[model samples]
Target: MLYLSQVLGLVTLALWLYCVFDVITTPDTLCRNLPKIGWVLIVLLFPLIGSIAWLVAGRPERTQAVTRPSAFPEYDRPGRFAATSPDDDEEFLRRCRERAEEQRRNAPGKPQDES
Candidate 1:
């Protein structure tokens, strides 16, 4: 019974300390119900109940995390291989050849004979 009480006391102390630090570190805007300083005072004055109150009422509500788009979006998928080199891509080669042919046909040096 004595050991259990001691353990409980330690737990309560840890909770109190955690609440105090958490309140101190938390941003002023995020704190709810009361101001950040008020929450800190509550936790310091009333150990167990204050800590519980801080957790329940003063702590900021969790928002869904926003994932930023990656610069290399191609590699973001699971179970995927890296993209093939441009030289190995048939479509890329075909496009390059078509572009070259179009440029050749439109060459400025070529004389156009008008009918």
Candidate 2:
């Protein structure tokens, strides 16, 4: 009986601590019902009841999977061309070949055999 009570007390303390920490850490914008400071005070003042209240009313609503914006915004723009492979881009390969040929022609050195 005494052991059971001890266990229940520990559980309550854990719940209270968790609620307090959660209230403190939760962003003001994300907190529901009451403001962040209000939630924190509530949790701190009434351990069991406040913890339950925070869980039921003050916690932020769980959102479905959030689609974050891409780190490279330019690549995510609509109508942007995205090539799967450089080798598959014929226009890009042709430009590279033209640039290489121009560089070879303008080389300032003894002309080697063009094999």
Candidate 3:
């Protein structure tokens, strides 16, 4: 049983390493809510639990599908929304409000928005 346990331990270590590397290298969009660096740090600092955490909950939801390079045609265009602003979220909200005002002005009718 000791020999079997040793093999199992080694296999677990290999799996942990694999997860750590992938978590580190994948983009923030790929990592979703959990920052990529934070995930990598968690895995590196707490190998056993971190690996399990990744397997159970760390991976982003499939709402953002994985890009398969093999599936892309030679003339495939890059994604448009790849850039992220770590800056003020208020700016985005401000833009949304401005757009709504403009749209309302352009639209025919009274603007009775309750917001």
Q: After superposition, how far is residue 101 of candidate 1 from its true place, in Å?
A: 33
Give the deviation of candidate 2 from the true structure as CA RMSD: 4.1
- Per-residue lDDT for 24-105 in model 1, tens only? 9888888999999899899999999999999999898877233468998878889887678999999989999999988887
lDDT of each: 0.88, 0.87, 0.77
Model 1 segments beyond 4 Å from truth?
64-115
- How large is the C-alpha RMSD of every model relative to the true structure? 8.3, 4.1, 17.9
What is the C-alpha lDDT profile of model 2 across 18-114, one tens digit per residue? 9998888777788888889888888888999999999999887788333567899999789997667989889989999999998998788958668
Model 3 alpha-carbon miss at residue 88, Å: 55
TM-score of each: 0.54, 0.71, 0.51
Clashing pairs in 3: none
- The collision pairs in model 2 are none
Model 3 TM-score, all chains together: 0.51
- Give the winner by lDDT: 1 or 3: 1
Model 3 lDDT on a 0 to 1 scale: 0.77
